[model samples]
Target chain A: MTKTSTKPAPIRRDWIAKSLAGTLLGFTLAMGCSGLLILATAGLSPGTRAQFAMWLVTPIWLGVLSGCFFFSSGLRAWLWLGGANLLVFATLLLARPA
Target chain B: MRSDYIRIYKTVHTWTGILTGMALFIAFYAGALTVFKEPLARWAAAPVAALEVPLAETPALIAKTLAAHPGAAKGFQLNLKPTEDEPARLSWVEREEGQDDHDTLSGHHYSATLDAEGNALVSESQPSQLAEFIDILHRVVGLPFDTDPNRWLMGVVAALYALALVSGVIVLLPTLVKDFFALRLGKNLKRMWLDAHNVVGIISLPFHIVMAITAVVFAYHDGLYALQDKFLHNGRLANAFNQQRPAAKPAPRDPADMLPPVTLLERAQALSPGFEPSSLQYVNLAGPRAMVRVWGTDPAALAPRAMGGFVALDPWSGKVLSRDFLPGTQDAANTTLSSFFALHFATFGGTPVRWMYFLLALAGAWLFYSGNLLWIESRRKKQRQGEALPGQRLDTRLLASATVGVCIGCIAGISLTIAAAKWLHGHVADLNAWHWYVYYGVFFASLAWAFWRGAGRAVVPLLWLAALSTCSIPLTTLLAWAVPGLGMWANTSLAALGVDATALAGGFALMWAARATARRVRLGAEDSVWSARKILPSCQGLS
Candidate 1:
């Protein structure tokens, strides 16, 4: 096995901030995504749309939460996910049935 | 991935996995048994004289039963093939007042049959809840009750479990190819355990993913539906699943006019040739919106739910009201959704799939157990050759004790309670409450014993206890048959026999574990917490 550096890396974890951002922002992002899908599938039956909307949220929420750690910093994670949530929810609001 | 990202993910995997390992162990172990829940229920059920109400007589039976007990008009099930679990031709459960919708156990069970004189013989029944008790453990991670709080806790654990899976995959990605399927068993036990853990985790990644995702969905589907109702459906999502018919002055309908159970079965079978009808669930039979759900299995297709799929029918005209959940007849979107349930519940591809799930679930339980051992081993303190033996770290010792206590205690507790189902039937006033008492009693006692004796000292004895308790399941059956004086009874059905067979094998496995653990404790390295033998400096030279 090759020897590697034992010193600490030069990156910040920001665990608490990252977790908070991931949890709160990730949820909104998931809800927004599901809302968009529900609006897009308005032509389908209500039961089908409801099923899709309900089931699709968890995977998306978890995906965002998992990906949150990959962000360079917690602030960036919050900013990007917050922006995505805003855009998606705006589309949902605009396209939703009156 | 960057090396620092890999390092961060490794930390994530370790913390998430350690936090949920024992709870997930109990969940997976109980879940493995729950895959054969019907057989377990059958094994625990007291044998009764079979009620031979034929298919042709079900209509008359239903009418007479409804006439005698009008409350049953809300819902009643006509069992098509009466097994040891449901020996009666007709049975129904009435939920207690103010009971939660998800609570399946707190209900008044009643079964009806036609006597020799052709009259409805309705009797209140207390079917054994051993299987449902185990199922509750599986659903809520060893919690006694299936309440919202317990389910929400389970949801949190499942979320962490999913995170663990993803982070674990990422951590392994660095050496994914080099260590793929490598099981090097040698002096380095940590490496061996790690290899074993990786093999199971990687090979069964898809299975674990399905379990984690479905578990989260199952726990939080109600809240998800509420959110959807508010945002997506304009607060009307609940109305979608329930068929809406314009009410033209609601009136009570006669149960006598409803179509027979056989006709509903025939219609369901005609719709899907592979669908084998198990029961006819008559919902709201006296109401204008009466419907019968033909519940059954389709071996060739995915089931939408654990009790298999159903096709709602208008009982009056035998018209198919809804085919959305019908297994073989689902649309593409429905099939995709049903695949989740079917994959998690092992409801498709018949008996072979169920067996495969049972083994995979057991393997999953082992994966959690081995993960804990790996954590403990990685933290083991090594003693130098010339230096005096150093004390192990407090955290590792405590964690070792807890891991053994919770996991082994759960195994012994479930097995002993299963045996008690036969032993304590008529002797107890409320057998169901006694089931809880026995399980918690053994579980807490085992935990206490583990702490008092230390994990190394307690592990072998606990393994013996688990083995003896599991062996008692089959032994109870043997005594029931061989010794007629015993009040316990045994069913000769294949399902019940299968339960006995499986328990016997599990018992031997636990015995082997005890022997292996004893060997490790006595002969393994002295520095490890698993070692119980004390080496004195003076005696080392004398020996």
Candidate 2:
């Protein structure tokens, strides 16, 4: 006998979502790399430390969004992990001295 | 996404890849080698003492030469110092006013030994043909004719490459997550090939995109000019554009006796604070229309092709006529343009950056070749049984032929040309001519060979030819060394050594590949033997 299978439908890709994701990826990668390079060369200014910290968290956000596109059982775990990392990065960015 | 869109993208990708893969392969591969052009040039002309002449002395030399040979001074450029690989060379082209033609004069190169005050002591030498050949290969696919068609063709290819990249990403979307970092070594041929293709494509996606975009910018510079004229400058484009363009201004027609070289230099220095005079040109000094241009370099301006400032000085009164920095518009645009070219041409930062770019470029070439292989392998089983469509089969064959012909052809042609350079150095009229002859001859020969022999067999032989030709580099060097008065131990010797080293490595690789093929043939024979025995036993048991 054949077994009937049911799974959650793939997320509908709206224009807004796609545009947001693409923009996020581009901005994050550019800013993150740029910030890291600057920081490595000359330590970050106190005024810009928060902004740099926010930029660093962007990769995690991208990882979560990318995971959502697939149908692996471990995807939920990946999303959760990515979310937690983003939160920690954001907290650090906010807490940095001006 | 809609299936229709995916289908359209797939078609676009397929067509583009089929159309432009060959040319792109050659350009990228040769370009990679060009990153080490200086080293290769040095290797070609080895055993010469390293020398550097001061910037100030060059003006004196140029002025002296101009005074002696008025005919040769027209539109001349003096390269002041030699880099590690190249000896300091002076090149001038003379154009007589009444004549429409220009004659070039070279081989007045000088190497410097430092004096007690640490100034240059000058010595003369000839140009290196090997260096010239390598440059030609990088610039125009080593074609004999002008670069107009090649540039236009590359523009179209670059557009197609961009299309391919976009479509490839679309097709790969569904499997990307599962297969990211996946390399299935053991399995069906198609699967293995696909994995390899996917991994390389993803890893080097950024490089491929940059190459495609930069290629378009370089190849379609005319289009950019047209666009700028139409949009940026409005309908009065010509007038607006000309104002920014480098216009030749007529100098005063006074017979100002040649001013002191020191005074002219001082004036130029005063105008441009940081830059030292790199070269000086005196226009029509004897009769009328005399002007001096002192060209200099700005270390900070080395970020890209920002022509820092070339100051033109009135030699007689020490008046600064013009102080020009490469136009701001050009610099802003060239930030992207120059960086892209620098990245592609491997001229960004010094040796480390160039070496990195070289390795990346080679990887990019491999990526293209593997992509073709993956496509072919996907349809191989059907193709073998004649089940594939006629058009599809034709495309597959064509792509295969191109892959073998262009890549291997370039290697073989360039190597042969370099060898010919040494052999025909003094014998050839205009030593540069031998470069064209050898390159074109080998290129066409390879193409013909590819057409005659099927791609399957052509690959092995062509690869071997490439390997052999490369090995000749060392042999050429040895020959140069053995022959007395050949300038073998000179700076040009390094170029020969580099070629030999590269060739030997290539030869060994080809030999190893040939050995692997032999081993595969043996394995196939053994498989047949086992199959025959198994079939006979099965038939007997059934009876």
Candidate whose lDDT is highest: 1
**Docking quality level of the chain pair in candidate 1:** medium
lDDT of 2 by residue, B1-543 (tens): 655445545655666676666666677677777777666666655345554555555555554555445554344544544544444534454444554121122334443344456443554555565665565455544444326576667665675677677777877877789999998986465687778877877888887877776666566555544543353223443553223232565554333244656677677666545555555655545434345666655443432332233566666776665453321222343344345445555544445676687778777777777777676655542313322222335656666667677777887887777677566766767667767778778877887787667465566677778777877766777776688577444234444455567667766876676556444333322111101122232333321
Instruction: Put down candidate 1 lDDT per residue, B1-543, tens digits, no spaces.
Output: 689898888888999999999999999999999999999999999887866899999899999998999999999998988998899999999887788988988888999999998899999989999999999999999999999999999999999999999999999998999999999999999999999999999999999999998999999999988877886678887688775674584676677987777777888889999888888898987677788999988888889898999999988889988899998989998999899889999998888999999999999999999999899999998877677777888888888888899999999999999999999988998999989999999999999988888888889999999999999999999999998788999889999999999999999999999999999888777788787776767633321
lDDT of 1: 0.89
Worst window of 10 by summed lDDT in candidate 2 chain B = B524-533
What would the TM-scores of all predictions be? Answer: 0.97, 0.65
- Highest-TM-score candidate: 1
Stretches of candidate 2 exceeding 4 Å from the true structure: A1-98, B42-59, B71-74, B83-89, B95-137, B140-142, B230-302, B306-337, B382-398, B482-500, B517-543
Alpha-carbon local distance difference test for all models: 0.89, 0.55
